[model samples]
Target: MYTLAVCAEMVFRDRPVPERAERIHEAGFEVEIWGWTRHDLDALARTPAHFSSMTGYIRGTLTDEDGAAELLRTAEQSVRAAEQLSCPRLNLHGTGLDDKGLPVVPVAGEADGPNWIAAHRTLTRIAELGESAGVVFTLENLNTAVDHPGVPFARAADTLALVAAVDRPGLRMNLDLYHAQIGEGNLIELVRRAHGLGLIGEIQIADVPGRCEPGTGEISYPAIARVLADLGYDGTVAMEAWASGDDDLALERFRSAFTL
Candidate 1:
């Protein structure tokens, strides 16, 4: 059976974490993936025992070779927090990127040899931490055109490459069609390719013109859903939508389009 996870960022709307959790529960979603520590997670954890997952990051203080050790340490802490709340998965962003739109490096010419080595070491450490925690970590593909410019893993190939470098059983890719379509065309083809490489862990969608809701704009979501069903993908098809107007109306429209 395919499952659905709502990104709390889509539904919370700056509300209190407890209110967000109650709303999510009321909406009938059992599992969720929340954003970085931008909300009152402690209170949210107090919600009824439901399957949940959290998104976190390795601190920037852990980017160097000496810092790589702390990458796994912080990842372990994230895992501990998840386990405390019975969360099984932890979504991650790559080092070449930042989730909060903060620039990490100065305008460099290009990713040279030293850069690659440092990045690989940190990724490897993160994978080790994830494996040890028995908590799968996924590198999400961000929309470089609008949501995330200049971030690595903006391209599907780059995401695939990072997974390759991480090279761990616990490492995978959070395949967001919105970002993939924004950075690269041919969403179905990319899904097939990633499946062939055994890298896809989660899938998400929204339209192009506006990330309002699924099928609200130019995205052919039914075709993508067909591909997902055809591939027998046993993973979550998360709804990463924005509901600025009527949230329920947008959700209903998304449900109609994503009906499988």
Candidate 2:
């Protein structure tokens, strides 16, 4: 019941998306795309037959008001692709503290409560639009220490609260274990708590320190895996680790770790 999403940047290895899709299928896994754009339409157009197997599409950003609306439109297009391809989910990143390289607001500390409210409002609007497009919108949490150093809402509790505030049936979260480890040490407990709140919709995993494959870090992924199975987490378990030059070796490393 687990699947992997290939980040276009890591899998770019000079191979095209269609080739990546073929490789993923050959590896006995369904495919989720990290990022796709209009420019990719040409490469994607050539593989209409393979598109129906996509698990989900991760949309990058939609900061401004119009940009958010445009993202909804894009999600519509992605949903068409997903339905044609039989994909189930669409992941999204929230707005940052600023747009156009200027600080308009912040969403981290108590002082930025109003800013966070505005940001979540934007997220709610986007989520509604996504529902209209027939795609589930899941927010991804980024670790400020490793990646996405700006803005706020780094903690899983806070992100869960944002999802709660949004309160849309289709709005959910893409919980990244690496970022959760860096931002919140008690990842399993947090996962359990989020599950109790019915917030987590999808999950991704990678070890911290180097963002390498699982078992490369201090996190007890086997225990975490047990927790996930017990929680009845039926969503895709994407291996969102960084490329270590050899994908086959990395996949084997992850498979061994998880299986053992």
Find the candidate with the highest TM-score and give its number. 1
lDDT of 1 at 117: 70
Task: Report the C-alpha lDDT of model 2 over 127-197, residue by residue, as the tens digit.
Answer: 77667766677777767665666545656666787888888867788787888899878988888887777
What's the CA error at residue 113 for candidate 2, in Å? Answer: 2.4
Candidate 2: clashing pairs of residues: 52-85
**Any runs in candidate 1 off by more than 4 Å, and if so which?**
12-14, 31-36, 49-51, 61-63, 66-70, 96-100, 106-110
TM-score of each: 0.87, 0.80
Candidate 1: tens digits of C-alpha lDDT, residues 204-246: 7778867778756778887877787788787777777787576
Query: Could you tally the backbone clashes for each prediction?
Result: 0, 1
What ranges in model 2 sit over 4 Å off? 1-8, 45-84, 96-111
